[model samples]
Target: MQTQIKKWGNSAVVRLPATMLAQLNLSVGSPVDLKTEGDRLVIEPSLNREYKLSDLLEGITPDNLHESIDWGEAVGREVAA
Candidate 1:
């Protein structure tokens, strides 16, 4: 689809069609990366790293673990038992 670039405030903007946006699963406020390759402009969804639980727990062992803290008693206000 062809879109004309129009001036919006101090920047030039090209509106993407609803169909294109749907195909790309992009919505308003979605982050996008833009770059110019030679004379061509490339637009893509910004990459976000989604870390796995295993990866986050990597290298974590009991040897490096700290003892759990215990709140001895409810010194402040206490609710019904």
Candidate 2:
């Protein structure tokens, strides 16, 4: 289905048809990556960049709950001091 391009203030906006929107799984406020290929333009969804566990774990410190352990009397002795 073909859609019409209307004048929006200082720029022209293309109102995508309902069929094309449904086929492309696009909705309002969705980010689109537009590029020019030869004489035509291509529009698609942008790649979502996500952070890793290292990013989320920044400035986090490990607990030292076992700092009171004692192993001086016997080989297998691990009594908490």
Candidate 3:
């Protein structure tokens, strides 16, 4: 399928067909990664990962909740207790 590259303000824009977009599960405001492979333009979903609260705290339990760290004395302007 051929598409036209139209002028958008000062840059060129190629609008993807609705069918193609639907096939890729992409809708308006979806993030995508674009790159040039040799002479081809490749578009892929962004690698940005989204996690739920449960996913982030899965391995954290009460046993490790209050684990202390030996972060040596603050060298900067820190208020000493």
Candidate 4:
């Protein structure tokens, strides 16, 4: 597919078709990496991965559990539980 570069404020922008974005699993506000290789512009998705809280908690076990530290008596109007 051929696309033309258009002026967007002070930057040049190229609009990708919805079909192309859907095929690449990209959406609005998705992060992408852009580079130039031998006069060719390469656009690719960023490598950053999003992690879920439940998935992260699954890695913790009794073997690697840590004990809470004991802080001394609180000063300066601190509430005691």
Candidate 5:
């Protein structure tokens, strides 16, 4: 499939067809990485991985834990310890 790059404000943009996006499981506002491979332009989904709170907490251990620092006495209406 071929697409035309059109001028959008000061940037050139290509409108991908809905069918193409659906095939790739992508939609509007989806993160994507664009790069040039040789003479062809390549567009792929970003490799950003989402982390779960539970999974992150499981990775914490006493070996990597640190003690909290005391920031002196609170002058304003801060929560008391």
Candidate 6:
């Protein structure tokens, strides 16, 4: 994806096509993180970053006993089953 960097008003910007943006799961105001992963520059939607469920649940207590199942696999099984 060789995109030309062009001048945007006062600063330079790369125009991401709508298709490309959507493929990358990006939207007009979606947050993104920029970092050099290994040797390549990686640009991805910020929300795609992985966070532990425990981190998100923080102080919340599970009301039921079945909530302890690993959600990713559980969802996969539920969908596949």
Candidate 4: tens digits of C-alpha lDDT, residues 1-81: 999999999999999999999999999898999999999999999998899999989999999888989888788678756
- Compose the digit string of candidate 3's lDDT tens values, residues 1-81: 988889999999889988988998988778999899999998897877898999879979898787788889798878656
Least accurate 10 contiguous residues by lDDT in model 1: 71-80
Off by over 4 Å in 1: 49-81
> Which residues of candidate 6, in runs, are more than 4 Å off?
37-39, 48-81
Number of clashes found in candidate 3: 0
Q: Write the per-residue lDDT of candidate 2 for residues 1-81, one digit (tens) a residue.
A: 566779999998888876777888888778999899999878888879797999867745576333566546755546555
TM-score of predicted structure 5: 0.59
Model 4 local distance difference test score: 0.94
- The regions of model 4 sitting more than 4 angstroms off are 49-81
- On lDDT, the stronger of 1 and 3 is 1
Clashes per candidate, residues 3 or more apart or on different chains: 0, 0, 0, 0, 0, 0
Candidate 2 Cα misplacement greater than 4 A, ranges? 50-81
Of 1 and 4, the candidate ahead on lDDT is 4
**Residue pairs that clash (backbone atoms under 3 angstroms), model 6:** none
> What overall lDDT goes with each candidate model?
0.90, 0.77, 0.88, 0.94, 0.94, 0.75
Q: What is the lDDT of residue 27 in candidate 4?
A: 96
* Candidate 1 lDDT over residue span 16-75, tens digit each: 988888999999889999999999999999999798999978968989977989868787
Distance from true location, Cα of 16 in model 1, Å: 0.3
Off by over 4 Å in 5: 49-81
Tens-digit per-residue lDDT, 1-81, candidate 5:
877999999999999999999999999999999999999999999988899999999998999988999999889889756
